[model samples]
Target: MPAQTGLRPLNMKHGWPALALLPLAALSSIFNWNPAIILVLNITSIIFLSQAITASSVELAAHLGELQGALLSATLGNTVELTAGIVALVHGQIPFAQSVMVGSILSDILLVFGCCLVTASYNKDVLGFNNALAKTLSSLMMITAVTMLLPTALYASFPIAEINKKVLLFSRGTSLVLLLLYGGYLYFYLGTHNYLFISDNAETDSDEDDEPSSPLANRAKLALSVTRLIAAVVATIFCTEIVIENTSDMADTLGVTEVFIAIFFLPIASNSTEGVHVIAASRTGDTDSAIRVIIDSLLQIGLFVIPFLVVIGWCVAEPMTLFFDSFQTVAMFLAILVVNHLLRDGQYAYIHGAMLLALYCSLVVVMYAR
Candidate 1:
């Protein structure tokens, strides 16, 4: 939809290949029925999502005023679950899908943002973070991330299992508490006038909104855009279904962790468009816009993913709970802590991204190791 004709060089390379492979993957998903085939389809989605991030990299070069539009496209693109969640709710699937939405939010904040921060860090120095504002918003996100635990905490009157009542309570309680601690460090480091969290430098020689791949010639061309938008939305939806359907079956057949599937694979697939966004943002050096996309991704996960999943689980609620799990909860805490300390100067770089990536990588490694 967004101009596939006069395409740019496609600097964000991972996704183009993935996108190209999709037709075959989709076909395999339908006919093969083999879990491995499904897993391949799911993984291809991840590659495409990674490409979305790369594709959006160019938007960062736009003028300050145009930044808002860039944010809209990138953030909205990263937030398919939010759209899907709304669609599902309207269609009356709200019981279990709701929790998946929560999980999505959690995954975005911890996993996506974490990866962004880490990758940005490795790429270059973060300019600096907004000390006071970032801390406040981080706190808000942290609260929302952990609030689902009310059920587990209040209902656990007796000590249970290897984890126990006290352990579980501490696990949840301390997770939130660490955010405060992390925030405190960030405040002192940035607010106390001792340190700056991000790099002051941004990418240079970048024209902010100069869409490398132009699809418009004048206002008269606007009419053509509508058809493209619809097609894009429809394509995304069909692709998403293929992604989830195959991934779900694969998880069942392979006995891999469900959270692992959702956290690592689902977002990658759903956010395939992000690969396009990231490269554009990175090329333009508009870290702010890129970060905003990251934020939108997190919000969509929260507002869209958890809600939709909650509805599905609600429809079949006797066996399992579709709410937040321990691994995800811990990951959220760790993410908040990292970003709370990292975003003070309102700039980003290689180190910040690296740190965030490290956290997520550790989580994934451990999950696979188990």
Candidate 2:
């Protein structure tokens, strides 16, 4: 049996602190506490639950083979964002949900990846990864950017009443196409060319760390891991609903636009664990794994989650379009361009990371002002 390469078992030291926040969050929500208090508590709790989901999902995915396990882990990793987006949509907060979709991709590529690069390059002048993998991911992101651009362009060039139906139809059709493209990307990633993505160090480590276990014990562990994953996901849904319910109130209290909150805060809270994981991987000198995590996350949001949300919106009669606001569309394009440019040579330095973080901060300031 191969050892679980990127998967980490749950750590009680970190888990208990976050788990302790859950009851407080529940009580705050139940007692009609201040919206800010409720928001903080619930968002913190959701972040913790998201971590729990990741840890348990990793354990469960370990039971499956490498490619299948990687796929499962990637899908499960976005559960928090997906759950939060759906909850927002169900409440008819279309703009809020859309902001989240955009923010997630930006945060992953610019913010999270930036932090990873900074960490990896702290003692070293240059950090490097697989150039082929970087280029492939970048090309896919460019395709996603184009998909996003077309709808926004269509909506912008026409009258609202005349273009609204057309935009929705185009979004739905384009979403289906993007979803298929995502499927093909997955097949390419996990089936045909998986060796390109997997790091030699990870394979060597797995082989060295492989240990024997009885079949019955493995089954028991798998069952336990699955149960924990399900429980964490359920808890996350509950906490996410609480957070969404209070989001508007919190925004009003803070005197910030709800779009600002959605773009800046929600993505950070939802993706905190994954961000930390990326940084950790980079710190351990596993630049390949860290880069993969960052790119995989960006691709998943762009190709899978956003399109999936559009289809879901159609079913719910919410008419979610791919037409992001002009600012958001530009931000997405610029973020992708910056990341792709930096990674073109498969090398990065702390200065590159700092530049990305600076860009992210500038976007935050602009969004906040808007």
Candidate 3:
């Protein structure tokens, strides 16, 4: 548990920014501060919340075994985005919710992965990861893209009468299939092929002497971990609600489409936890773990979060559909294509990272223009 080191002297190197900003953010929202100020606070708050979430996830991972821990962390890490999407859905922000789903996929593959690769490239000209792992994840993501495309294609091909009703049924059926696929993936990765994700060499070497041997100390650590996890989640929910509520006004103020907000800002905010985790991994030369984190988050977004949102919408009287706009479908497919090309050789370079970033920026510009 992280509590064992609770009293350890604070390192100025990596202080918790979220812990500091959260109070101001909360107060700003409650006090009806300036919209620009509130917007900045909200953005900063989410970033900090994401950092806290990542911290708790690391502690939780220490308690659970690696594979289970990683999976749990990834799922928990995504909870903020999932929760926000649901809120948007129930509020009749279907386009917003859909944009979040697509944005998460794009950001995780292009933005987060690019950042990690850039970080890794800083130390060495080129870094290598396990090809088998990369290939397997890429294949799964590509299949996911195909599944997503199916519903939209079906909707387009059919007659337009009762279009919403048709889409609702198609989405529900598709959601079930996606949910099953996600379950199978969890079983495969966590139960059968868990060994593949685990690294023989630990990323960081810690002296045994650094850890307190007392059982009481261990228990305290566990309790602290649980507390932090709970607090981070609670705080995240509050801040996310504020952000979601204010998002439209903010977008209008900034003279951009809500899709621009969802595609670029929201994903970056929601996926901040994974972004932090992956970049740290890359910095420590844990390229394999970094890549895996990026891929797994993408998988979670496509398979679990999207389907979960659809089902949640159905229950909440807001029937969400998988029938994304043409732009979204093309963006997702292109993002996957870029990821496949970059990861196929099991190598990472700054140039490739820059290219990925460029592509993401281009998409953002196009979205803003729309």
List ranges where model 1 is wrong by over 4 Å. 1-22, 42-107, 110-127, 157-220, 252-255, 272-276, 279-285, 303-322, 344-352
Model 1 residue 139 lDDT?
56
lDDT of 3 by residue, 181-256 (tens): 9878877776788667665434223343256568887788878877877887887788778878888777778898
Model 1, 1-370: lDDT tens digits are 1111112325544344555666776777668668776677645654554444334433321222233433344344544465444444444443323434544554555555655554444545435545554664565455545654544554465445533444434444444454355345334433563322222323222333234544455333334333333444455556555655455467777777554665556555555455344445545454444554555455334433343344443454421232345555566656665665565445666665656657667877876665
Hey, what RMSD does candidate 3 come out at? 4.0
**Model 2 spans > 4 angstroms off:** 1-16, 66-71, 156-159
Question: By TM-score, is 1 or 3 better?
Answer: 3
The Cα error of candidate 3 at residue 262, in Å, is: 1.6
lDDT of each: 0.48, 0.80, 0.76
lDDT of 2 by residue, 140-255 (tens): 88988898889877877889888988988899999999899988887887679877777776777668768999999999988987887787788778877887778778889988
lDDT of 2 at 307: 92
The number of clashing residue pairs in each candidate reads: 101, 0, 1
Q: What is the lDDT of residue 68 in candidate 3?
A: 64
